[model samples]
Target: MNAPLKITKVGNSAGLILPKEVLAHLNAAVGENLTVVFTTRGIELSAADPDFDQQMAAARDVMARRKRALRELAK
Candidate 1:
């Protein structure tokens, strides 16, 4: 599904307006969050995973706290 969206001004911030059909295709709605991942190809957008943020935060904390151990294990 390809959507050609235009960037527009929302108050002071610039954002893209996802058309209703596009949002429906994503199984998303207005005011709902979408996860955007920038891969080598381009930007990928999908419906947000509720626990993704928490899992990422936990992983970051673990990496920070176990930096030395992880580095050694990477050898």
Candidate 2:
């Protein structure tokens, strides 16, 4: 869990080479965007634009409240 990553140069950009196991743990693929946050302690990498659960909850609320109106609009 505490694998160290060495910084390496990639053409004009600096990057790290993650092992296949680590990449699988991250569930990341090529071209996927990661949100990087630096704290006083360390850096955190996660999928960008979080709050997916919150967004889904809000969407459910909207769907529940608009069921009738949406049904009417559909006709």
What is every candidate's alpha-carbon RMSD to the true fold? 2.3, 9.1
Off by over 4 Å in 1: 1-3
- Which candidate's lDDT is highest? 1
Residue 45: error of model 2 in Å?
Answer: 0.4
Q: What residue pairs are clashing in model 1?
A: none
Displacement of the residue 58 alpha carbon in candidate 2, Å: 14
Clashes per candidate (backbone, < 3 Å): 0, 0
Q: Estimate the TM-score for candidate 1.
A: 0.72
Error of 1 at 33 (Å): 1.2
Give Cα-based local distance difference scores for all models: 0.92, 0.83
- Residue pairs with colliding backbones in model 2 are none
Which lDDT tens digits does candidate 2 get at residues 1-71? 88898999999999998777776777787777777889999998876655776998999999899999989
